[model samples]
Target: MNLENTLAFAKRQDEADELRDFRNQFLFPKHEDQNFIYLCGNSLGLQPKVTKEVMSHQLDNWANYAVEGWFDGNEPWMFYHKELKKLIAPIVGALPVEVCPMNTLTVNLHLLMVSFYQPKGKRFKIIMEGGAFPSDQYAIESQVKFHGYEPDQAIIEVFPRKGEDVLRTEDIIIKIKENKDEIALVLFGGINYYTGQWYDMEAITKAGHEIGAIVGWDLAHAAGNVPVKLHDWGVDFACWCSYKYQNSGPGGISGIFVHEKHFSNQDLNRFAGWWGYQENKRFKMEKGFIPESGADGWQVSCTQVMPMALYHASLQIFNQVGSFEKLRNKSIALTNYLEFTINEVNKSLGTNQYTIITPQDPASRGAQLSIIASQNGKQIFDGLMENHILGDWREPNVIRLSPVPLYNSFEDVFLTGQALLAITKKILKSS
Candidate 1:
């Protein structure tokens, strides 16, 4: 697609889009009777129209059945996760039995680390990407300390090359090889939050396995943004939040994946609770904890009906589109077009005022473009907000614009480009 900066070009692209109707399913925020062009799905997703109806139906069930809703409803609360795991499995590329909807991302990470982060005397270090999301840093730091190891000595961070903006696959693999004997766990975000770099999961998993270590991923940004085969990649464990790309509501239910190979391993320690006990034998409530088969065994508490209901509303939307493979094609195009638009802004100004820190290669990133404006970055971001264009700002002058394929259109990108040009010009002229 030869790109154009005109509004007509953008409208034509939107007119031909197959997924255009799906955009109507979401309720976008508005100011002064005009809808904002929302490009913040990487931070928070728009609410789906079906979410309210689903929530109301669940509320009705609560009013009618109350305590009996656990077993009496059309979708019983006791068995609801099975239905969700079926929907969630394909998103992360795993068997239905290998995935579970449970606690939030960091909470799930902590629970999984309790089982996967076992360390002996020598091979006790955890290797990860430098400048990970703060939650991951805090979680890993506490886990190592719980095992009686100093943070500095127990955690090895793989950084990008001196002049580069993202980590190299070979450099990451070399880091694993360098710490082969002492590396107990290899944990990384599937797509880095700040740089928007998608790591080679299969290569990293193979590297970790070669060195006799467990590999895991925190797919906070990648789960619904890109396609990944955790099962085929031999990734041992993974977790993600559904609120961002999945469009379940804010603080939505999180998901975890433990490969089928680990399901029957009784030696893996977990913080057991009654809900994880064998379902058929649960009411008997007798002696020791005998976990249910598959990933359901990791459950720590009873079902959360409302959150699952909200999640179910969005999962049905994904089910309508079928899979991430369907969305990936459009994702690459939207991100590329946005990148091109940013470059055009700099070209028009005859200077490199806007620099995209995200990798230009579509394969190395998802829908996000992390932009750093050389002048008045914060002012430019605020201008977009005032103009009914909703992107998000990170600390230290990074403005992230994520053009989600499911809801965002090419016209949105074009209009955003126009807004950026006008804002930059106005800010520079006034200064």
Candidate 2:
């Protein structure tokens, strides 16, 4: 598609968009009296209009049923997550039984490590991307330490070649093979949170399995933003937070996926809780832990009803618009428009005032474009906020803007570009 950088073009695109009406379903933050052009879905999504009503329904159930809410009520607390599982499976490309909603992102990562990160004598290292989200870095660091292994010794971090901003697939695979004997687990984020590079998950999984290592992914940014076939890719386990692209509230519920192949492996370790017991036998309250079949067996506690309620609100939108095909198409177009608009900014200013660090290929990224302002970077980011354009700013100097297809319009991108141009012009004049 030949991209244009004008408000008329953007409004035309939005007007012709089949998914345009979906934007009306969300509640956007206002600046003065106008809505802010929210380009921060990679960090946090806007609240769905339906979130309040659905959450209130759960609150009403609590008031009406009290302690009996577990068995009674429309969405029984005992099995509330069951419907959620069905909603989540397609989004992450798994069977309903292979996925379960529970815990926070890092908590689920730790729980999964308990079962998957069993390091034997010779094979005792975990390999992952170097600049993963801080949660992953902290979680992996602590997990290795808990297992009585030094963090530096037990972890192999694959880094981008110096001068490059993203990891090449070849470099990652070569590193995994180099440590084939010592690497017990291969862990990676589905998409690098900062650079917005979507790794070749299927290729990485195959390489890990070929080296006789268990593989996993933290799909914090990729779960709903990009396509993933976790089960088909033979990824041993994976987890994601619903608050970002999925549009659940802040610190919303997290989800997990365990392939069906791992279901019958009774030797697998887990920190069990009452909710994870086999359904029929749970009420009997017996001694030994006979785990519930599939990923549900990994649950360490009962559902967090309110968090799940928030998550369910978002998943319902994903479900209503089956097969993320349309959303993906729109996402690609929106991101491309954003990139084109940014380039237009640089061209107009004739100084390359903003540099995009994210991968150029649509296949290698999702909705986000991480840009570094040539000068006064932080000030430029602050300017964007003051002008009612909400994007994420990383330390040092990276402004991450994500044009989410669900609620974002082409006009939002156009307006953001307009604001960015003005901000850069003002900053250049000052300095």
Candidate 3:
């Protein structure tokens, strides 16, 4: 997979791409006089052309049917979430019954914890990656406190070795084994947000289960960026937001997956709402909760119709593409090209100006390459933005660029490299 640093080579690769047409379906933001090279799909995705139309249709139903919309219309409000389940099931690799489009990511995390994070006797500890997304850190800490345990005593965070940027699989497994006795749950992000490391979920699941711990994932970065097999991996439960790689609008609907093994477990508790009641008897207004079977049982409220509609429009694109395998193949190549181009920049400069923190192995990471800028990183990031080379910058000088398979072209990656090289040169010359 040799890569060239020329725009012509990138255009040639784009010309040969079968998924090239997908870029047209998304609406890109304009910068100066042309479309900005958007590589921030790791943060927020571009809107689909169909999203507006689908949203209008739902709005029209609301205008015409009002409360009756719940039971009437083409896609009845009552069962709309079910339609999303069918489209999303394959994307996350789960049976339709095991998945549901529901509450936002953190809310679902808390709700699922009530059922899965049962601590008893000496087993009250939770193991997670050190430096997990702040939301997860907050959620885990709050859950520990709510259960009457101190955060410092109840949580174990596994970190990379002092000099390494990514966690080794052996280190993570060893930590789980060492804390096997006191662990009540092992919750981790499927992909670490800052480093872009995709953990070995199957191995983690097995290790946690050996210790009699429930394992779950916060897959905000992993869901559509990389291929996941939650059902096959026997993951206890998982949740994800659709706004990132899934291309749903900002604050889009989130999804949850609960393994079928937990469906019949009567001891598992849930904070229920009317929508989560058994569908047939829901209108009966019966007392005592009879949760709708499967993951839907965890729902605490009715669907957020507008957001779900936006998400559905994006899922349609995924459906048209057929499978995540094709998207994943292109993702690997695109990220690889970006990595190669960045390395070439460093070599040409005769110094390591950019250090990629993301794992080099395609299997160990997704589309994102988190690069640590060696000098004037913030100024370089500003230059990229001014040039409409849209990548995100984190504090302390890391720039994350993700070339999405569905909407981003190889040319996008090519131009991004050019911007980085140019910006770095200007910064060094002035210094």
Please give, for residues 185-269, the per-residue lDDT of candidate 1 as tens digits: 9999999999899988999999999999999999999999999999999999999999999999999999999999898787998
Q: Which stretches of candidate 1 lie above 4 Å from their native place?
A: none
Residue-level lDDT of model 3, residues 1-431, one tens digit each, is 67899999999999999899999999999977788999999999999999999999999999999999988999999899999999999999999999999879999999999999999999999999999999999999999999999999999999999999999988999999998899999999999999999999999999999989999999999999999999999999999999999988888889999999999999997888988899899889989999999998888898889889999999999999997899999999899999999998998899999999999999999999999988899999999999898899887778999999999999999888888898899989998
lDDT of 2 at 159: 91
**TM-scores across all candidates?**
0.99, 0.99, 0.99
> Per-residue alpha-carbon lDDT of model 2 for 4-42, expressed as tens digits?
888899999999999999998899999789888899999
The candidate 1 region of ten consecutive residues with least summed lDDT is 317-326
For each candidate in the order shown, give its overall lDDT on alpha carbons: 0.93, 0.94, 0.94
- What is the Cα-based TM-score of model 2? 0.99
